[model samples]
Target: MTTSTGKGSIVVVTGASTGIGASTARALSRHGFHVLAGVRRAGDGDTLRANGIEPVILDITEPTQVQALAARIAADPRPLHALVNNAGIQVNGPVETLPMAQWRRVFDVNLFGHVAITQTLLPALLRSEGRVINISSIGGKLAMPTYGAYAGAKFALEAVSDALRREVSPLGVEVVVIQPGGVRTQMAARGVATANHLAAQMTSDQETRYGGLVQAVNSLMDSGTASGVTSELAARVIVKAVMTPRPRTRYTVGRDAALLIRLARVLPDRALDHLSARSLRSHHPRTPTVGVLSRLRVGVSS
Candidate 1:
């Protein structure tokens, strides 16, 4: 795990309490980088500290906390070597029914928050000619049904990462995006739960119209969580991005992600639409006719 340039290097990893973030932090620490693991909760910080990485109490969505973290790092003599923006949340629902609040919350955590942290740390990064690694998603490139909020934020993040890369490269700072497919994580479970909750809140008429779609989305999420690549695999890619002298502008971390990206590039829009429709229909528990017929039968019996 050791890296030629990573020995004693200082790196900050946000959302380090679990999944890819946690794995990346641990991997970097083992590779001889001094990892400052940022966690939202004090208990999470304790967990990181127990693992031998320095824990910083940070909530990327909160500007004060981000500023405090930056100030603390700036006070140290060592220049920051890397900043990994890995904190994000997934919210799933039909765009028409999804709450604007949820969309804002997702963006706050996934896009705006990371942008703030990156801005705050730019000076430190510039001083060391460091790298900014943004953990985006396959959804960022190819939006999926019921993932509008999550995808929107990720899409925005991709654009921001691109702009930042161009702007900071002149200053010797590298900006890269890591797009991972379904990685086995709690996020899948949370997404499924959120889908269910959102579906439950729908009116009867709305449910009649969108229930199958909701079920399909939940099914997809379950499969993703069950079959996704390991977070460790993602962490390996992140470490490579950080340690490589010349890194690509973006890296797809999982096989599925790479395939999706390829498909997005090569497939015609009409073909992709057909594929997406097929996937949804295949995953849906009940066909539209079956659902309608079942409801009619229940109505007649009553």
Candidate 2:
């Protein structure tokens, strides 16, 4: 698992408590990087350490933690080789009825958090000739009904990634975006809950127009929850992008990610939206399997 770059290279990965972040931490460790696995909770950090990783307390949404990470890495003499910004959350519902609070919550973590952490660590990255890997989603490229908040934030992230790549490439820093279609994670559960929460907050007429849509979205999340990519597989992709001599700017994962993105681009917005609605409806369950799918979606991956 060692690389020619040397085992002492320093790597910083955010949201290492679960899903892609946790998997990336372990994968990078196997590659011999001294990983500073960042997690919001101390208990989660302890779990990472138990698995042979060095855990650091970090919440990307917190300014102090982000600054501390920068300070600590800058003070250390070891070259900072990579930064994996993998922390994210999902919120789903009609944009019109979506609570402003929920919208802000999603963006705060998915967009602003990534930017804050990256900006804070940019100096170290420049000094080490390192790369920044943003763990975005297929939603960043395609818009679907009921995922307005989540998709909006990811869209912003992709734009920011594009800008950062241009801004930092001259400084010997690289920016890579990983756009995964569907990897089973807590994200789906959060999206579903957001749907219900938003529904409750809506007016009767608004709910009538969109309640079925939200339920359909939850159903689609359930049906699509089938065996997908594992976080380990995603981590492998990140490791390749980070360790490769000439990394690609964008990497798309999952079976349908590429096809869907292509379709979304070629098809008219209304057509694509209708298609997504149909797909959502087809996945909603009429039986007990619905419950299973919902639970499975909370942590399953592509």
Candidate 3:
């Protein structure tokens, strides 16, 4: 009940309103750890309240909310054991088309928000010799056609994790990055919806250039999620990272993630391009309903 696994102690999981975060909170609580589940709304918190799970209203992008989380931990009787930075938003648009404002918003929620919370809670994590579990995507290593903002932020997060791990492991804290492939989360649905919304606002020229590609990527997202692992399964990997004595610095959540990470390591840049373009081609429309695959795909030849 006392040492670092948070067993009978405390752990915090953000974005607990649904998906992997919610599943992780539940799994940790079941392991006898007290879980502070972070949600954006009180109703969501109410839905998660249970024996060992306490739901906290947290929007990681908000400074006030982040400080409140730190304060709550400061007052708790149990030592804080881990901070799961699992909250994220998915935004997809080509580099030239995504608005500047949207780009900032993506970084704010995906990258900056995690950094702020980690900085605020470092004292407690260090005190407990706890772990910081960051949920990254396979997109972190493999950037696709329309994932300009999302993947850029994830790539930065991966680098930050490396730097933080080097700085903190010597200080008794562990930073672990979780690379998930297409886990069947609501994120894919939300991402596709957002992508379509942005596509609708594109100029005629932008639409002509990107519209078909966007549609193809959306289809790919849907198929990927349909074939993805469950949130509970993904949570099991996170729990392992939390419970293991000397966990690996990074873990891939599913088979797709593991294979893709391997491919990223070995595949050349041009090879990745052709692989990506071919994958999208299956979902691409025929007869040039919008911009035809031939027009959309530039570098990859038939």
Candidate 4:
């Protein structure tokens, strides 16, 4: 770890290779924070350095990396002001048919990794009276069938955030959950690919039951990718959370995130499920395909 005198508050961002994580690191650096960009690969670190950002080699699931990150931060004369636990993976399929390995892998990075990194850095955060931001999804509140594993981990993260928020408020550390409805990212593309792949693998009867639903959701997602707020926009919101005198415990962003998730909450489970099914059937009106990237490219340009 290269030690530099902190001209501004220090921020550590996990999963800083791409998507929200990478964009957030760049945005925060622009905001004048001494951004410690965290990536699992050294090549990513080199890219960050080329861009004039400090890249810390980190793998949130690895205890040693987390510990090493803590040591590096602890050695810094300046206090660490913020930590963004934005590293996550999306694995979607029929819950009954999904491999246990998929579920475990998601949890390892999405839930437990956040806990481990936060715990390791709690003292520094407390000392600086900083904020910990967890990038969760609206799926944490509304359980989507194929999105079960990812949603489950997010739900657990929400609980963890809520509990820790209360526990640390008095101690000067703030915990914030940024729940996004959707955004144009690799996670979305991967989800579409997973659905299309699984649809191909399943029996005709199984496909008949779940195929259209996946197609509809993918259509909805693909429709929104271009219009959804860019990662840089979302990062600005997060930076505000860190800088604000009083930050909200929960922030739901993106189009219709609040209304849709709230509706899912108030509606009865069976009724919501029915509504979801109907929405899937009618709202999208498109077929699922593994070619999400091309669609996203065209959609972005349009």
Candidate 5:
């Protein structure tokens, strides 16, 4: 860990190699924060350094790397002002057929890894009265078919954030959740790849059982990606969560995110189900009859 004579409030942004995390690190640096951008690869570190942000080699899911990050920050003369847990992976597949390993991997990165980092950094954060900002997704609130693994992780993250907020508020450390609807990021591409790979791996019987539903869900995901907001927009929201005098407990970043949140809160379960099914139907009109029927069944069961 190299120490630098940097200026202003200090922040650590995990998964700063690309997408929202990278944008947030850059934005925070521009806003006068001495940003420590966490990356998993050496090349990514070079990229961040070239852009004038300090880079820390960190893979959040790796316990030793996470510990090294905490130790380095502790040793630094500058007080840590914020910790942003933005590192996450997406696993898109049917819930019934999704591998347990993939589910564990998603939760490890999205929820457990963040918890470990937060716990490790609490001392520094408490001393600085800093903030912990979690990057979640609109899927955190609304779960769609084939997005169960990612959404499940985010949902758990939200619950963890709420609990951490209540527990740490008295200590002057704030915990916030930023849920972005659909940000134009590498994550969407990764999700598409994951979905495609999973679809390819399915046996004939599994395909017959889950193929239409997966297609419907993938179509919905494509729609979200098409209308996604910019990563910089999400970064701005993150900066607000960190810099605001009295930070909000949660913020929905994109306009689409805000709308989805509103609908999730106001609409009854059946209404949401019907709307979701209809949207899926619009995409895969012919083959996804099973998808619609399954959705209706789930709605009725609920």
Candidate 6:
């Protein structure tokens, strides 16, 4: 799962406190690269510092911290091999129910933060012809009910990656996207917690419309995580994307992700809608949630 070809080189991985980011930092270290692992807390950074790995305090949303990371890398002697943009937050809510502030927060963490960090480090990457790896999700390809904000940010990330790839590939910098289905990472539990928190804030009428759906989605998320691939495996796929000489523009981490993304590419909108609804319906609340979306259809009966 590793190669020493990266000997003495440098790689940066964001959100390295736990899960895939943490695993990726270790894996790249094994491959002989000095890893700059980005964590939010000093405690987290402390835990991740060892061997070839050095953790940096990096809240990608904060311009100061991001610039600091860039400066640290710029001062280093090793050539930058790659930058893995793995930091993320998941906030699930229906488009009609999600507050604009929450929506912006999602984009800030999931999309804009990556853009800012990439912009900051492009000089080093251009100097080394290094790659940019973005950790996306199957949700980027197909949005589910109550996943409007999360999926919207991911979809935007996908587009940004595309634009970046086209803009930089000719200049020798590669931009790659990793879309994972259900990886057994801590993100699911965090996402469920956030979903419930947002659900609690909904208006009485909004709760009546979305509460059951929210519970169902949470249930499904739990099950998916239970059955998904391990974070170690997901990290290996990302490492593969980094080490491959001429990597694909996109690499999917799990079988579910590969299959679902392929389907999304070929299936019509109505067909995909039916598929997504069927998959989610099985996890619907024991209560009658079937009429939830129907309520949206039923406005003033003028």
In terms of lDDT, the poorest run of 10 residues in model 1 is 289-298
Top candidate on lDDT is 3
Total backbone collisions, model 5 = 0
Model 1 lDDT tens row, 269-295: 888788778877778775563454355
lDDT of 6 by residue, 191-283 (tens): 998877666666668877777878788889999999999999999999999898888899998899999999999999999999987888888
Q: Which candidate achieves the best TM-score against the true structure?
A: 3
Compared with the true structure, all predictions reach lDDT values of 0.85, 0.80, 0.90, 0.79, 0.84, 0.89
- Between candidates 3 and 6, name the one with more favorable lDDT: 3
TM-score against truth, every candidate: 0.92, 0.89, 0.94, 0.86, 0.90, 0.93
User: 1 or 6: which has the higher TM-score?
Assistant: 6
Clashing residue pairs in candidate 2, if any?
A: 183-301, 184-300, 184-301, 228-302, 229-302
Give the poorly placed runs of model 2, Cα more than 4 Å off: 1-6, 50-52, 284-302
Candidate 3 global TM-score:
0.94
| Model 5: ten consecutive residues of lowest lDDT | 1-10
Off by over 4 Å in 3: 1-5, 287-302
Candidate 2 per-residue lDDT, tens place, 1-302, comes to 21345377888999899888898899888878889999888999888884337788998998998888888887788888989999888778788877788889999999999999988888788877889999888899987788788889999999999999999898888899998877776667666775665566566567556666667777777555455577788888888888987789999878777788788779888888788767876655455333443443444432
Give the CA lDDT, 0 to 100, for residue 225 in model 1: 70
* lDDT per residue (tens digit) for residues 124-198 in model 3: 988888889999999899999999899999999999999999999998898999999999999899999888777
Residues 1-302, candidate 4, lDDT per residue (tens digit)? 11222345789999998888888888777766778889989987877773436899899999998999999888888778889999988878777666788889989999999999999999888888888999988888887768888899999999999999999988888899998876777778877777665555655556656665666776766766756777877777777776777788988878667887789778888898887777666655355533443354355456
Candidates by lDDT, descending order: 3, 6, 1, 5, 2, 4
Q: Can you list the residue pairs that collide in candidate 3?
A: none
